[model samples]
Target chain A: MTAAKTNDPPPPPIKYDFLGALLSYLVPGLGQMTQGRFGKGILFFVSLYGLFFYGWLLGSKKNVYLPDYHSGETSIVSRLASDLYTRFQFVGQFPIGMAAWPAIYQYVVSVQGNEKPPLNGFMSSPSLEELNNLQRNGDKTWDLGWVYTVIAGVLNVLVIYDALAGAAFREVRATPGPLTPPNGGPSK
Target chain B: MTIYVHLPVLIVVVSLVYSATRYDSWNKILREALHWGVRMTSFLFMIGLVLYALSTFL
Candidate 1:
């Protein structure tokens, strides 16, 4: 009257891959290559960076930026809110990781309130007046250019997840050994 | 215009990036991307048609 016990292999252990995620965040598709997924890594890196740089080119290299200009708000919260409000586009651009760092660097230097900082203009923050001028003078293509950068950055968020989680549909196959289960062989 | 020229490229990139997240194999990812790219392009074209008709009528 007793039912027979069945043996089922345990699910594969899920590793918390901090470094992989970090690497992929810094450079798109890097984590996958580190994890031996070379093709995906290459695809990710080339595609993401291509899109990002193309957008940079479209915008004439002035798309990704955090403005040094901020209205004098009393609290840290207000200042933070003001920055976000002004640079809301940065939320999209920021996820591309270090590629977007120049903007932040520009802001830090700008805190000194320099009339003209001695730094390369790469992703540098423009003054509020300058930003307005750029917008007024430039056309719709400029808007689309930043949109490309934003899309590239946002897509990278997914890449980071994939780097940490490994492939979503990957089967956890035990190595071939005396005790290992024999159902499927190596992937094609 | 640059915007119109870039639409297909955007679709292809978006499809490839999204497909990469779903599967490990490059072959499967690329295949899925092709399918999704077509679907997305068609969807967008339909929406454009609808908007165009609305603008003309209204």
Candidate 2:
């Protein structure tokens, strides 16, 4: 009698966790933690948050900000240029989720100027002269701090992708050996 | 001075997060992170040195 062939089990269905993605967007690494990836989640949390706070500490919490758009500049070109240089950094900072909320809130307050006791304390826009003075006097900490914070946020974008899609690539198990001739000829 | 002081720490944080996303194995992640961090720091140092040399000459 011929033996019956055993069918292989089907692969598990891929489930897209939208809520988890949202959680991660709201708070870095939350999605991974929700998906039981505690180690990865914790790593992202500590690293991203640490970098964010380090930047804040270095810059006195004033590095992340939007330009004062409503400062009554009527020239479109100047306004656009100012926004590009001053506010465009928000693009990088936005991905860090809650870590960036305070900055966003401060930006809104600065733009509206209606809020009593603005959300940002001691956060005044430094004039060009003052900035030059700071740089000349060897106070380049603010520039470096701003860059670090922006980079941290950019890194979170990758972390968020990993959390949502899982690891980008799988670990290769087999050791790669040197190629051999088809007929097992003498090795080169 | 402050910028240079934080450069190594920033490199480590960046490498750790970057490698963690690329690999699932903790051992592989840590190993790759150190490798990447060293590589990146070396690259930056080389660039800085080149720039300084060019500035002096030009």
Candidate 3:
């Protein structure tokens, strides 16, 4: 009597949803929480809140300018006091201020000069004619703040997901599971 | 930098306490700890979603 030998295919690879994870990562706390990481997720969200408050405080002091095409000017809204600015700046990296990504992108692109012409209240530099033209045609500058905010929001979601998923995957891998024989064969 | 820096330390502290109380052996500890971690992480995930919505609307 001879025993038969059979080869079995390898188990299917564990599917890792990288994009889903990335979405979580863009946010402070998300993905892992979705998978059941409650503590970490809460911590991340709280951290985000702290950063936002800090930025809000800082943004309160100096003008956080958002160009308004309709008005044909840079609408420089007064921000918080200098004290608030200093306090917020100290923790700037965490909450990621309103201008966080915008500042970083601007720096990366090496935009030397200010987009809004340095002048008094919004569109002070532009003549009446130019202002009228911008208003009629549409102002890209005004939209920049909102656009950036949306981008940041989207990125935050991604980050949160990524963080949670990454941790979950790591935890899963680190924890061992029961072993089984290859080829669906029973171990004797 | 403010809260972010403190977070790692906080996570570690919580993990230690959780492992100490919730775990019996290495495997048990690891499993429980991970489960808790994931749970905590998920909570944050929901909060983040809420915040994102808040940011968008308000």
Estimate the Cα RMSD of every predicted model relative to the unseen true structure: 5.4, 8.8, 17.5
How much is A179 displaced in model 2, in angstroms? 27
lDDT of each: 0.84, 0.77, 0.42
Best by DockQ: 2
List where candidate 3 sits over 4 angstroms from the true fold: A1-28, A61-65, A69-158, A161-165, A168-188, B1-58
Q: Considering only chain A, what is the TM-score of each predicted structure?
A: 0.79, 0.69, 0.33
What's model 3's TM-score?
Answer: 0.29
A63, model 3: CA deviation in Å? 6.1
Please state the error at residue A130 of candidate 2 in Å.
Answer: 6.9
- Candidate 1 residues lying further than 4 Å off, grouped into runs, are A1-10, A75-78, A128-130, A173-188
Against the true structure, candidate 3 has what lDDT? 0.42
Candidate 3, residues A2-112, lDDT tens digits: the string is 977655444455557665465454455555466565565565456454434333333321222322223222332222233224333222242333334443343223223
> What's model 2's lDDT at B28?
88
Error of 1 at A3 (Å): 18
lDDT of 1 by residue, A1-188 (tens): 99878564666777868899999999999988999988889989999998998888888788888775464777656775687688899999988988998887776667657656555677886556776777798777778889999999999999999999876676656666455336656544
Better model by lDDT, 2 or 3? 2
